[model samples]
Target: MNKPANHDERMAKMTFGSVYPHYVIKVEKKGRSKAELHEVITWLTGFDDEKIESLINDKVTFEQFFEQANLHPNAPSIKGMICGYRIEEIDNPLTQKVRYLDKLVDELAKGRKMEKILRTE
Candidate 1:
């Protein structure tokens, strides 16, 4: 049986696997934490959730998972060894996460305030 188009769309909509293919991520040039860097970068890649699940389930290799992903792109401000995404333009996952967290927190605060009012009434 063939999966529905929705399956692909669902996958496309997923954030864990959705990588910002065109962002520039630069870690400290002198950082020697390859393992840490790899771990951090993996989550930001598209299909991150799927890839992470596969890693846990033993379905794919790390290289294959992030095959299209890139390291931090070069930054013009500083002059030193640098690495980041190599795409023309991409959104940064960190920024997205921050925005999401902020929104979530605001929602929770509103909920809490509502709860307090309800409790008093």
Candidate 2:
């Protein structure tokens, strides 16, 4: 009955705030706005602007961030590869959710329309 190894440790050690700046830079370089990035994140994780600000300011770990988030109903609609992994095929639920966000941001950075990224179209 031993717990799994450092999977949680790795995920927990990554603070969302630590990564936010990179995301901003990536999208901005491609002529996208920070507001669009925020919108995609909020849509996926169900965190509002205020809550997201608080989470970033607090340096919350990915674990805590996902724990508090009420994932959107359409999250499963997000699919495709990110960082070489097929998001929908990831077996770990937490890992899949993380990759889902990454995929969305990648799409945004690539200049995909918000409606398409959100799967609303």
By lDDT, who's the top model here?
Answer: 2
Which portions of model 2 miss their true places by more than 4 Å? Answer: 1-8
Instruction: Encode model 1's per-residue lDDT on 40-65: one tens digit a residue.
Output: 34423433544455543554333343
TM-score of each: 0.20, 0.90
Model 2, 37-108: lDDT tens digits are 899999998888899889999999888899998998999988877777777877778877888888898999
Q: What is the lDDT of every predicted structure here? A: 0.32, 0.86
RMSD values, in order shown: 17.4, 3.8
Error of 2 at 52 (Å): 1.1
